[model samples]
Each structure stands twice: as C-alpha cells, then as structure tokens.
Target chain A: MNKKSMYGRTARKIGCYAALLILAVIFMFPLYWFFLNSFKSYEQLFQFPPKFWVWPFRLVNYLEAYMYPAFDFGQMMKNSAIITITSVIGAVLSSSVVAFGFSRIRWRGRDQVFVLVILTMIIPTEIVLTPLYLIYSKLGLLNTWFPVIAPFFFAKPFYTFMLRQSMMGIPVEMDESAIVDGCNVWQRFTHIILPQVKPTVLAVVIMAMQDQWNNYLEPLIFINSNSKQTISVGLTFFSGMNATEWNLVFAGAVMVALPILIIFVFFQKYFIQGVVVSGVKG
Target chain B: MKKYTVKEKRAIRQGLLFISPWLAGVIGFTLIPLLLAFGISLTDYNFLTKPRFVGLENYITMFAKDPLIWKSLGITFLYAIISVPLQLVFGFLLANLLNQKLKGIVAFRTLFYAPCLVAVVSSTLLWKQMLETEFGIINYLLGLIGIGKVSWLGQTGTIIASVVFISLWQSGKMIIINLSGLQAIPTAYYEAADLDGCSRWRQVFYITLPMMSPTIFMNLLIGLIGAFKTFTQIKILTDGGPSNASLVYMLYIYKTAFTNYKLGYANAMSILLFVIVGILTVFVFRTSNKWVHYGSE
Candidate 1:
C-alpha cells in the first residue's frame, strides 16, 4: 500500500474504534449513574463536578427502599418469580405443541392459521387494549394474574415461530423411525422431539422470563390492586407525585433490573445463539 | 408404511390435541380482541356505557373533525421517519466497526448491548434526571461549554429531540442483529474485491452493501413498525407535553380510550393507525424484493 493509503486506513481504524468506545461509554453511563447514585446521600447526589466515588458507602437507601411502607420487595420478587416461571412454562409448552402442528402436520387450512398467527405480529397491541380490557373485565379476570398469565397458555407468535423453525430442522426420518418402533406421537414428542430442541426450549423459557419480569404496561393497565401488582408496577410508585425521591427510586430500579441483568450476563451466550438461530430462520 | 384409516385419524387427532391450547389462546386472547376492537370502532362505546352503534362517526370525526388526531399522527410519523433511518445508518456503522477484530471486542460489544437490557422505564427516568433543566448532568456539561441551560423536556423542540435520543440509544439491539448479518457475509467477496483493485468505498458498495441488504430491509421494517408503536418512552419522558408537540399516535389513542372514556374514538384512531402501518409494511415488503439480496435464490 502507498504511504497515503496506509495513513488513511490507520486513520479510519482509529476513528472507528474511538467512535464505538465513545458511544459505548455514553450508552453505559446512565446505568452506572443509577448504581452510583443509589449509594450516595441526597446532598452528595447533587454535588457539582459529580462525586465519581463516595466514601462510607451507604446501604441505607436500599434497606430503606426495602423497608419503606413495609418493604414489599420480597413479595414483589415472589410475584415476579411466579409470573415469569408460569409464563415461561406456558409459553414453551404451548408454543412447541403449536409449532409441531404447524411444521409437521399436513392438516387442511394449517397454512392459513399460521398466516393468521404471523399477522398478529404486525398489529400494535395498543389497538386492542380497549377491547381486551372490556373482555377481561367482563370475564371478571381484572385485578387477577389471569389476564397476565392466560396469554401464555395460548402460543405467542414469536415463540411458536422459533420452535417451529427448530422442529423443521429435525429430519422427518426421526418421526418415521418412531412410527416404525410403534411409538405414539406423544411418546415421540416427549422422548425424541422435545429433547432435540431442548436448547430452543430453554431459549423460549429465558425469553418469556425476561419479558414477563420486565412487563410493565400490561400489569399497569390491568391490575389495580396493590397486592396483585408485579415488581415493575410496584417500582412505579416511587416516582409518584409527592415522593419523587431519586435515591429510593434508583434503589428500586436497581432491585427491579438486577435479576434480569445477572441472568442475561450469565446466559448471554445461549441467549445470543438463540437470537441468531431464531433470526436466521425468520 | 401402512396407510390405515384409524392411524391417520389418531395422528390428526393428536396433532389437533397438542395444538389445541395454542389455538384456544390465539382465538381467545388475540383474534377475539382484534375483532371486538374493529366492532367497537363503529360504536360509541366507553367502558362504563353500553356500546351504541355510531356508524363511522368516530372515524369521520377523527379524520374530519379532531385536529389533535392529525397532529398526533403527524408526530408519530415524524418520530418513525426521523428515528428509523438514523437507527439504520448508525446501527450499520456500529455493526461494521464491531465486525473487525479488536482487543476486548467481546467486552465492548457487551457494554454497547447493556443499555438495551436495562429496563426502559428505569432508563427513561434516568434520562429524565439527566435532562432536568436546573440541575441535570447534561445541562451541567453544557454550562462548561459556555451554553446556557436549555430546558430539554419542558420545551417543544427539545422534548421531541430527547425522545428521539432515547429511541436512538435503544437501537443497540438492532445494531447487534445487524452485526450478526454483517459477519454472515463470506470472506471470498472481499478477497475478490481486493483482487479487482477495488477501493474501500467501492468494496463496501459492491460487496457488503448488497449482501447486507436483506438484513437492512428487515431492520428498517421492524424499526419503522416499532417506532410507530412507541409509547413507553413518550409516556415516561414527556408525557406528550408542551402543546402536544410530542404526543404520539398511540399515546393519543391511549388518552382517548382510558382518560377521556372515548373507546369508540380510540378504536377509530387505532384502526386508522392499523391501516396506515399495514399499508406501509406491505409497501416495504413488496419493494424489499428489489433491494434485499437473499443468500438463497
């Protein structure tokens, strides 16, 4: 390469690296801010030149956030756990079963129904919010977890598509062999098919967990009672008119966001693989 | 294999049985709600009162009478158009950079992706603090640069800009998706370009650009759809304030339905949005064939 071209390449490379690093810092700083702010006392939080580090690190905010008005953190965590676990179970089981029908079965109008399922992806959920609210209210399911959890029992489109793609990758000969062994479809599903797509199933579980744990709008609109409120909604109370307490709010946010962050960090390889696998198929 | 009647019936039965739960849920939760929403669009239904047939009055009023409806729709369009292209371009650039070999690349990628994983509500709240006029960090930084404190959220122009900023930041996920697509391109293309004495810009033009088109197309469509439906950020950040400059279509529809108790009007607005989004999506999908290059024929 000519000296000028070499210089140009070096400049470009340096430029690219610097830009990415800067953007990354900008993206990450707010999250870092929340963590650091959660530990700082009220006066320290507003200090000019912004105290990057503070001594005598305080656990008081977190504890106070937990203990304030009977510190419903444990209960809220339990609620999130229950919702996430059940939703994941429901989403995986139902989507897989539905996916089997879509991918493997040759029933009449199956393609049509599958198209209908895909159609749901394009429409905004807000459009249906009112009608759904009416229906849920009429069914006496409002203020209960039923509205939140019932959708999972029905296959979500994304999950259904994910499992269907995974199932399609399995050879038809496997089903043929199972049939030759005089195994029923259910037995084949349990012994052969389910095990083959265990990773995809785990992917579905993790996704469903993340979605439900962070779910805010649905619970906000649907659940009215404090007792039924999920952690997402529970944390919203901190930002209410009178209190507007930054310290406690950051603590609550940290509490709300930590579990999913930890889960993502630990299982990111699986999650990224899952995303790529699903995306490539789609 | 013996094609026995009973066996065929049993397999079909099992298939239906297995899929029955999903079928039930789709119809119950999704299809029924959609249909009811369509039906409600024709009536004067609020939550409290029984739905009375209005026969397109809601839609007529929305289009012909309600000026706010148009303004909000305009805002939604603005938000989608402004943010989607910026996201695609920025995301593409980021993905291209990250596609290179670098030290601590994994850590850098993870750091970039972390903002996406943070709960949006929490992130919005943080942005709220950072943008606070008097004591916010952003303005504080601005003060050093000899710029006076600008009300980021309180003003019309700044509020929309702040919402756009939040949307742009959230584009990191799509950037990762783009990165994956970029990496999927084979090395042979670049090698061939090099052998042809192709310049960097030309190689990107002839090879990377065409190969990544399908992913770009997908991202664009998804981004457009996602942006049009944006509510959480608008709700948290500005609440569609300062003379409704930042009021998005969904937030408008939401207020119409829940706050104003105008379900019929809301449904009409929704149906209008639904049609607009659908038309745009189909247009993109149809035109995608022209621009998007798939690996397989």
Candidate 2:
C-alpha cells in the first residue's frame, strides 16, 4: 500500500511537469514562429510547409526594413524615445506628488477630491477625445508631441490611484517622526514616503514607459508628418504600403518589439509587479 | 463651523498645493471635455466650419434615423459579452495551473506573458499574416488536417472570432492578476482541508474558488470595460471589414469623428456609449455584494 501511494505521488508530479511544459510550448509558439519568420527571405515566406528554420539568416531584412526609405524608421524610433522618456518622467513626478497628497497629508475635503480622481478613471477617453482634438488644434498643438506627452505631466488618474494605494500602506508614524524633527511636508515626503515606496515608483516608471512606447492611436491621430511619427504608427504605415512583403513586415515588427522585450526580460520583477497592481486597480 | 488651527490650515493649503496638477487635469481634461461633448452633441459642426446650433438634431438622428447604429451596437455588445468572460475564465484557469509549486515555474510564467510584451500593431500584424488564406500558417495547419482554406479575416462570420482569438495572445495581464490573487489565498485553509482527508478537487471547489471570487469579479468588470474600448486590434486587423460585420462602437465613433469628419455626430454617439458603459459598470458593482466573497465573512 505504501509503494502504491508512492507510485501515485510520482505519477502526479511527472504529469504536472508534462502539462506545464506542453502549455509553455503552445504559448511560446506564436512568438517563436514570428521570430523565425523575421529571418526568412521574401520568396521563402510564401512557400507552403513553412520553413521551421532558416539557414544563413537574412540579417539584411533588418537593415532593409530599418533603412526603408518610405517610413523613415530611424526618425520614428527617435520620436518614440523622446515621447516615451518625457512621459515616463512626467508620470513618475506628478503621480507621486499627487498620490502623496492623497495618502500622507491630512486636509479638508481630501477624500472627496480623491473620489473625484477615481471618477475621472471611469469616464472613457472618447468623451474627451473629440473636444481635446478640437481644443489642441485651436491651441495650434496639432501634429505636435505636446498633445500626446502633456497628459502624463497632469497626474494621470490611473497612475495616481495606483501610487496612492501603495502610499497609504506605509504607516503615518513614519511621517510623524520626520514632522517632529521640523521637517516640512516636502522633506518628509522625499525622505519618508518616496524611499519607502521605491518598488512602486519603479513600477510606475516601467508602466509609463510601456504605455507610452506602445501607444498607437494617440500618435496616429495627433501626429501627421512621417518625420514626427512614433514607431507604432510608423509600422502601420510600413505594412500598409508593403502588405505583400511579408519579410519586411516581420523585420519591422521585430525591431519595434525587441527593445521592450529586452527591458521586460531584465526587469521581469517590475513588469509583473506593475502588471499585477495596475491590472487590479486599472 | 469651528475655527481652524494653524496646523489644520497649513495641512489644507499644502494638500491643495500638492494636488494642484490633478485639479488642473480634472478641469482641463475631464470636466471641460465632458461639458463640450454634451454641448457638441446639440450642434452641427465640422472641424473647418463654424458651429451651427442644431437643437437636438445629432441625438435625434442617432436615436431615430441612423441605419447602422443598432447593428454596430449589437456587434460591440456581442464582442464584449463573449470575449471578456471567455478571457476571464481562460486566464483564471491558466493562473491556477501555473500556481503550482514546481521548480522553474517562474520561467514558464514569463514565457506565457512574453506575447504581451509585443506592441499592439506588431502582434496584430503577425496574427493577420498568420490568418492569411493561402500563405498563412493557420490555414496551412488546417490544410494538414484535410480541411480547406478558411478566410479568417475576409468572412463576416469569422472576423469577430479572429480578433477575439488574437486578443487571447495578450491575456498575460489577466493571468498575472489572477495568479497574484491565487497567491494571496492563505495556504492554511488548504492545509486544513488536506488534514480533513478532502480530495484535491473538493479542496479546490470549496476553498480555492470562494477565495478567488473577488478577483474574478474585478476581472469581469475591468475586462468588459477594456473589451468595450478595443480599437487598435480591430482597426489594424480587419478595419470592420466584409460589410461591416465587426464594426465595434469605438471604431465607428472614430470613423465618424476622424474619417467622416462628423465631429458632432461622433460626440453624440460617444455620449450614448458612455451611458451604456456607465450603467453597466454601476450595475456590476451594485450586484457585487451578492457574488463577490471579500473574505470578511
């Protein structure tokens, strides 16, 4: 009976591993297929029984796609970098400060204002999309990065709420001790709240970067010029022109996705943490 | 009211100062634009032309005249209703599977999430290519099984399903949320159940599931909201193609606003959508007390 129970336990363990391994392969297949296809020649892309592997990888596809004259891929990458970096810095600074007020500071009508902040999240962006577009055009901000990047500097609701939830967890006594030392609010905030919630700050930064870097619709609508276009928008234009050219499409896709994938790999902890928290809250 | 102390007054002033950016944002972005959307819905104005006040004409046309409004709403509602719950279930199950205490499971979890790291445009395009009738991998696989080439994107019936399938590739966020929720379930309950000679399936049914109800409820609401707003995938993949079989509400609002340049009409439609989503969200929250197990009991 002991031997039979031991056998059953071993079978269960092996079965669990096998199941997980199969699911992993199935989950990874699309990406694996995509990466492999990016290296194939244009002629080979159409062939049936698709090449599971390619010999002498056509590294030139990356070169051709990047320097492809139509879309100005390099310029678009620069544009994406500028927009993403500015937005990340803006989100981190403004969200943290605003969250600090909501969590650490005591004041009249504070919870009511915090409730208002949460309400802003419920309203869809469509309600604001047309008016903002019209207003931006009136302000002569159309086709400029201002319309896209400026939203983050204004303490975006989702990020503020996430950071606020994290901040409220730290004991108020941390602030009281600093307050007794005659440290002003800013000093206490910087020395006390910010340092304690370092992981969340990092999470906010990565989330901001991911959001801005991958944003397609904002750029597509606001920025008209090819030179000013972000990579996500630029790739759409690339494939639009070269719909039949599978090789270039795959190459362009790899280029746009590689940087974020690399960042995600190095900072898996931050990505998962941010995703979990933001997913729950957002 | 009682007079404020010096510290009380100081705290109020400092709090307002710190949150001034959010105050500006609420006024500039939310309140002002919401007022504008309502005002615009009553007027007939294009981008280039001066606003001509047409009292209730946009709303009137939307409610009584437009031929495509109901159809598009149906498609959008169907898409959200079917896809959100489907994604929630699959994501939860995947999370449960991954929640096992095996070695190197974190690596497996990362692999599942890797698809989400690819930006929307790139992933959509890859899926589009794979769904191509002749040269695509999806059809090639079906052909190997003695089935004919199916036009995944070109057909009216399959377009919505195709987008829904494409979306599952990025269910990593949902999985992560559910996985975290599962981890937060105290192990002691399961330990007690094991001591009681409960079967593994029984332990899951009684202990694991009740603990997961809140997370599932949250995902249900958020997923529905998100599915309601899905645009990039649809616009890139099919663009509401094959006789508008898959034209979602947001896509129509977009086409009306930017493509057709009917700003007032689109604003009216957006207000309509806002009402639908707002009512749905409130209804979900109100009903939550019935089903969501917050562990307080």
Candidate 3:
C-alpha cells in the first residue's frame, strides 16, 4: 500500500504488541506471585516491601504442605485421582452411548427426549442440591464417593448434547455400511460412530477430568470426613488450618492446581477446540 | 397413521436401551429431586427432624421478614451486572489482539488462558493473600506510589469490587470463545471494507460487531449465570464476611442449608433462585433475536 498507510500499519502493530504484553503480565501476575511466595520463608513472606524473589528457596514448604497434620495431601491426591478418573470414564462412556442413541437412531420420541436433555442444561444445580443430599443420606451413601461419581454414569446433559451434536456430523453412510456387514446397533456404534467421533470424545474426556478435579462445592457438602475429601476441598481446609503460614498455603494451592495446569498445557489444542465447539454450537 | 414394522420396533427398542441409563438418572436424580425440592420448600425440615408441612411458611418468611435474602439478591445482581460486562469487554478486546498474526502468539494465548484452569478454591485463597492489607503485594505496590493501603476484602465498599476483579482475572475462557468468534468472521468482509475505503473503526462497528453478536450474546448469558452462581470463591475468600457485605445468593443458600441445617428454608431459597435464573434466561433469549445476528438470516 501507500507509505502513510504502511507507517500506520507498523504503528498499529507495535501498539498491539505493547497492549498484549501488558495484558499478559496482568493475567500471569497472580500465578507468578503465588509461585514466588511459595518458596519464601514466613518472615520473607510477611516482609513489608514483599521480596520479589526469595533469598534461598525453601523447598521444605512443599514438604510441610504435603505432610500437614490436619489433612494428608497424599491421601487427598489419591482420592482426587480416583474420583476424577472414575467420573471421567463414566461421563464419557455414558454420554457417548446416549449421544449415539439420540443421533443414530430414528425412534418416535427421540427428538422429544433430546429436547428434554437440552432443557436440563438450563436448570441450575441448586434446585436439586437439597433433595439429592437427602436422597443420598437416605440411601446411606452420604459419606462415600458415590454421591460425587455416580451421577456421571447417568449422563450429564451438557456433555451428552455436545457429543450428540458432533456425532450427528459423522456421515450416516458409515453406520449403513456397518449394518450391511451384519453389524447390529451396538456393533455399529462401537465400530463406526465411536471411532469417527474420537476427537470429540477426547475433548469430552479432558473437560470431564478437569471438572471433576476442580469441583469444590459437591465435595465440600457431601464428603464431610477429612479423610474422604478431594484435593480441592482438602486444600481449602488445609489453608484454613494453616492460615497464618502463607508459604504452606501457597504450596498447597500449587499442589492442588498443578495437575490441571499440566493437562491444559499439554492438551491445549483440544481444550481450545472444545471451548470453541461448545461456544459456537450453543 | 402408518404402522411401525418389526424392524422399526427393534430400532426403537435398541434406542431406548441405549438411553436407559440417562432415563434412570433423570428419574432418580433430577426429576424426583426437583419435585422433592418443591415439596421441601413448603415445609419446616431441619434434617434432624421429620419435615413438618408448614405450607409456604419459608417462602413467606423469605419475602416478608428475612432481609438478608433481599440484600444477598441485590449483591448478586450487582456482581453479575458489573463482572459480566467487564469480562465480556476484556475478552473481546483480548480476542481482537490475539487474532493478529504474530510470532509467539500461541504462547501468549496459553499464558492468558492458564488462569481459567486454576481451581477456584486455590485461586481464591491465593487472591485472599495477595489482597491482604498488610502483606499483600497489591498494597505494597500501591504504597510505592504514595497511595495508602486498602483492605480489599475487608471493607464493605471494596468487597464487591474485589470479588469482581478476581472473577475478571479468570476471563480466559471468554477470551478463547471470543477469539474463535473473531477468527470465524470471513476475511473477505474485511477485504471488501478496505476496497470501499472504510476506516478500521467503521469496519469494526459495522461488520465485526454484527458478525460477532451471537457469540457475544452467548458469552453474556454464560457470564451472567456464572456470576450469579459464584460460590467457591466467596466462600473461601471472605465467607460472606466483614458483616455479610459480599453475600452472594448461592453462598447464602449454601450457608442456610448446611451450616444452619435449615434444609426446607434453603430449598425455598433455591426454588426462588431457579425461577429467577429461568426468567432471566428467557428474557435474554427473547431479546436476542433483535440484536443477535445470524449469518443465514
């Protein structure tokens, strides 16, 4: 283009970079600060000017955090892993099966039931919290992991809808070809549709795992025993008990947050794509 | 009416079989609990005693006598109003920036999006420390500029603002969604705008904004609902504290049910919350047609 427009373009690019740099720093500051403080001693942590960097990194903070007397961080991590893995597997399998039924079959009431599935998305969980709690209590499943993990086996509407939408985009001819090869509905679903929607299934798996890992309120309410708590709830109680020790608190926070962060970093493409699909489709 | 053949009957049966788990879940977990919640809302159950049918007594008390309900609702509305738009604007602006072709853009995007992955409990606890009046880095930085330290979570005036600030800090998901919307806009439109000698500002106002309206609407709806349902952060950070100044609705219901053991009253609060959210969602959907542009239409 013209010289004036070229200069304007250059200036705009520079300005954009500047703005982005500032925003990036602002966004990353909390995590950075948290990490920096995690290694600081109590005196260093409470220093008036707030030391930008710890003199000698106290890795013992992590050790203390892990061995905190009030709650066992190792046990908490195990509980979190168990809950997250089981729930993700349950949600993925159940949601995919239900999605296949909705998208692949032409039942009389299919559309009507799918509409009900969509409607469930808008109903806030608060409405069912009390009664669900009572039902679990009545069933004598209150303190167990059943309350947290069992619901996923039933199929969450949001994940079901997401999977169904993606499954619908898979060509019908694949299922038809499978049927011609003497495949029943279940075989076709397993052999054709499941393989086709593997990417979306992976995305759903990661999202479900993230949700289960980060879930707080459910664990807080249902799993009252300190030993049974997930990382999220356990960390909160840890922080409360060690409120004065900022180093331990930050250490516990880091431990609680690290796995999800690692997952996001490694699987960012799927994560970003999942966010886009959900946003656009909704 | 056409009669179904045997083949069609099998397909129907198989379909039902596939979806049976969901049906069972809906019956046992969702629908039954919802009906039971409505029933409990009309009673005086405290989890320790049998639910005595008081017949709308909880709702009546909430409406007529309980002032915290109104105050908490007002606080929640304020939180939603301020935080949703703030997040939307920040997300939109950042998305526009990230849409540019640049080196290391992916790294920048990841950095910005990382906060969204942080667990709410941890993030709240981290922020609680960072906003501490005496030892917080925030006040330390303010002190450097000759500004006095402010009790971010302590003061009534600053409590909501602090909550909003922390919420906005995790606007990464919104940014990702907005970036997708931005990238989805056809580049041909911008090229055409350039051919017509349109200014960048005019192009954004006329073309980009309209094209992105649907995405914006989606973000707005999600943001509104999310802000209203905010619990873990407030509960961890302030515990609706410093005189209940930051008591959001969900925290109120949670405290009422769990801490006070007033299950019936909490259910009443929950039913009210559900209706309010439903109405707000319908209102948005109704208004969306006017402003939310679809490319096909």
Candidate 4:
C-alpha cells in the first residue's frame, strides 16, 4: 500500500510538471512568434505552412524598423526614456512624502482624506479625459511631455496608497526615536522612514517606470508632432504606415517591449511584490 | 475641546506640509477635472466650438434614443462577465500549480508571468497577426488537426471571444497575486486535515477555497472593472470591427470623443459608465460579506 501511494504521488508530480510546461509554451507563444518573425525576410514571413525557422536571418529588419521615416525610432526612444525617468522619480518621491504624512504623522482628518485618495483609484480616467484635454490645451501644454509627465510631480493615489501601507507596517517608535534625537519631520522622513521602506519605494519606481514607458493613449492625445512621440505611439504609427511590412512591424514591437522586459527580468522580485501588494490590498 | 499645545500645533502644521502635494493634486487634477467633466456633460461642446449650455440633453439622448449606448454596454458587460471569471479560474489554477514545492518552480513562475510584461500594443498586434483567417499559424495548425479554418477575429460571434482569449493570455499578474494568497495560507490547516484522513481534493475544496475567498473576490472586482475599460487591444485589433461586435464601453466613449468629435456626448457616456461601475463595485462589496471569509471569523 505504501509503495503504491508513493508511485501515485510521483505520477501526480510528473503530470503537474507536464501541464505547467504546456501552459508555459502557450503563455509565451506570442512573444516567441514575435521574436522569430522579427528576423524573417518578407518572402519567408508570408510563406505558406508558416516557416517556424528561416535561413539567412534578416538582421536589417531591426535597422529598417529603427530608421523608418514616418516615425524616428531613435528620437522616440529618447523621448520615452526622459519622460519615464523623470515621471517615475517625481511619482515615487512625491507619493512617498504624502504616504509618510498618512502613515507617520498623527493629524486630525488624516484618515478621512486618505479615504478620498483611495476613492480616486475607482474613478475611471475616461470620465476626466476630456476636461483634462481641455485643461492641457488651454495651458498651452499640448504637443508637449508636460501633459504626460507633470502630473507625477503631484501624488498619484495608487502609489501613495501602496507606500502608505508599507510605511504603516514600520513601527511608529522609529519616528518617535528620531524626534527625540533632534530630527524634525523632514529629517525623520528622509533619514529614518525612507530607508526602512526602500523596497516598497523600489517597487513603486519600477511600476511607475513600466506604466510611463508603455503609456500610449496620453501620448497619442498630447503629442501631436512626430518628433515628440514616445515609443508606444511611435510604434503604432510605424505599424499603421507600414501595414503590410510584417517584419518591420514585429521589429518595432520587439523594440518597444525591450526596455520594460529587461527591467522586469532584472527586478522580478520588486515587480512581483508590487503586483501582489496592489492585489492583496483589494 | 482642550486647548492646543505648541507641540501639537507644530505637528499638525508639519503633517499638512508633508501631504500638500497630494492636497494640491486632489484639488487641481482630480476634483477640478471631475467638476469640469460634469459641466461638460451638460453642454453641447466640440473642440472647435465653444461649449454651450444644453442641460441634460446629452444624458436624455443617451438613455432615451441611443441604441449604440445599449449595444456597447451589452458588449462591455459580456466582455466583463466572460473574461473576469475565465481569468480568475485560470489564474487560480496556475497559481495552485505554481504553489507546489518542486524543483525549478521559480523558472516556471517566470515563464508563466513573462507574458504579462509584454506591452499592450505589442501583444495586440502579435495576436492580430496570429488570429488572421488566412496565412495565420493558428488556422494552419487547426487545419492540420483535421479542423477547418476559424475566423478568430473576423466574425461577430467570435470577435468578443477572441478578445477574451487574448485578455486571458495575460493573466500572469492575477496568477502572481493568487500565488501570494496561496502562500499566505497556513500549512497547519492542511496538516490537520491530513491527520483526519481527508483527501487532497477535499482539503482543497474546504480549506483552500474558504481561505482564498477574499483574494478571489478582490480579483473578481478588479477584473470586472479592468475588462470593462479594455481599450487599446480592441482599438488596435478590430477597432470595433465586424459591425461593432467588440466595441467595449471605453472604446465607444473614445470613438465618440476623439473620432467623432462629440466631447459632450462622450462625457455623458463616461458619467453613465462611472455610475454603472460605481453601482457594481458597491454591489460586490455588499455581497462580499456572504462569501468572503475574514480571519477573525
């Protein structure tokens, strides 16, 4: 009976692994296909029966994709980098300050205001899109990165909430000890509080970077000029203009996804933690 | 009330100072835009023309005369209803699988979660090509299996289903969350059940299900809201094609505001969407007490 049960357990383990292997292939197929096709020439790309492997890989597809006249991939990458970096920094710092207030300080009406901040997460951005557009246009921020990046300087509700939750986990005695040591609020926040929540801050930064890097709609609306376009909108235009060039389209898609892919792979821990934290709160 | 001391006053002032950026953001970004959106919803505005007062006309037209509104809402509801449960179930299964203490589990976790890292436009474009009726690998494979070609994104019947399938392909985030939830479950419960001679299936049914109900409920709520707001994929894949078969609510609102230049009408539609989502969220919360098992209980 013991031997039979052990055999059954081993078989179940093998079954689980096999099922996971198959599901992983399915999950990763789109990406695998994109990478394969990005290296194929036009003739091989449209071949009947769909060649999974092609001879004499066309590495020039990447060059052509980058130099496509309708959208300059180099300029777009620069724009995306600047916007993502600055916005992410602004978002993390400002939200951390606000989160510090909510978590560390004892103040009247703090909880009530925090509730309002959380409520903003439920309010869909579509409801405010038009008015925001009007506001941006009126302020002459149209066709500029300001519309996309400026808001991060103010606290974002989701990041603020996440950081606040992380900060709350730290003991209040830390702040009290800092105060006794002649540290003011800012000093305590910078010296004591910030170091303790560094992991959460890193998670927020990575998340903000991903969001800003992949952001499409805001850039599509705000950046009318081709030169100002980010990678996401630029790739859309590139694909639109070269609808039939599947190789170039695939190349562009790969390029647009590369930065975030690298970041995600390297910071896998923080990325997973951020996602889990956000979901577990719900 | 007791008289305020200097230290208390100083702390209050410092606290306010720390959160001033958020205070400014709430006023300038969220509150003002919301109020302005409400005002816009009550007017006849296009970008070229100044907005003129037309009190409740847009809302009336939406509820009373607009067939597209109802049609889009139906589509959105269908998308949410179908996709949310599909994602929750698939994510939960994958999470359970990944929760095992096997060798190389981390590699499997990364492999499963990598798809969620793909950008929206890239994934949508990739799927659009893959789902093509002719010369698409999916169809070719189907033919090899002795099945006929399936127009994955071409027909009205299958368009929404195709979108849901694509959406479910990126359920890695949900899986991660569920894995975390699974890990949070104490092992003592399972051991106790084992001592009782309870089967694995029974242990899962009773222990895992009840313990994970809160996480599952949260995913359901988020999935519904997110599925309703899905835009970039549908916009790029079909653009509400095959006679608006996959015109989810946000896409409809987007087309109205940007493509047709009907800003006021779009605002009204958006307000309607807000109310619908708000009502649904509250309904879920109210009902959650019946299903979700808190630790205290």
iRMSD, all candidates? 2.9, 2.7, 2.5, 2.5
The pairs that clash in candidate 4 are none
Candidate 3 lDDT over A1-282, as tens digits, reads 799999998999899899989988888888898788789887788888788877679999999999988888899899999999999999999999999999999888898888788667667775688899999999999989999998889988877877887787777888888888999888888988888777678778877887899898888888988789898888766545334567887888888778888877888877666645543444
Candidate 3 or 1, higher DockQ: 3
- The order by descending DockQ is 3, 4, 2, 1
DockQ, candidate 3, vs. native dimer = 0.60
Predictions' DockQ, in order: 0.47, 0.57, 0.60, 0.58
State candidate 4's TM-score: 0.93
Better of 1 and 3 by TM-score: 3
RMSD values, in order shown: 3.6, 2.6, 2.6, 2.6
- TM-score for every candidate vs. truth? 0.89, 0.93, 0.92, 0.93
- Model 2: per-residue Cα lDDT over A80-178, one tens digit each: 999999999999999999999998998998988897886676677755788889888989999999989988999998788778877877887888889
Residue by residue across B85-198, what tens digits does model 3's lDDT show?
898888888889988888788788888888878887778888888888998889999898999999899865588788788878877767877987887787999999999999
Tens-digit lDDT track of model 1 for A130-156: 889998898898888988887887888
After superposing candidate 4, which stretches have Cα over 4 Å from the reference?
Answer: A1-9, A108-112, A239-242, A273-279, B1-15, B196-198
Superposing every Cα of model 2 onto the true structure, what RMSD results?
2.6
The reply for model 3, stretches above 4 Å from the true place, is A1-8, A104-115, A171-183, A239-243, A277-279, B1-20
Question: Who is ahead in lDDT, 1 or 3?
Answer: 3
User: In model 2, what are the clashing residue pairs, if there are any?
Assistant: none
Model 3, position A216: C-alpha lDDT score: 89
Model 3 residue B259 lDDT? 91
Q: Model 3, residue B297: displacement in angstroms?
A: 8.2
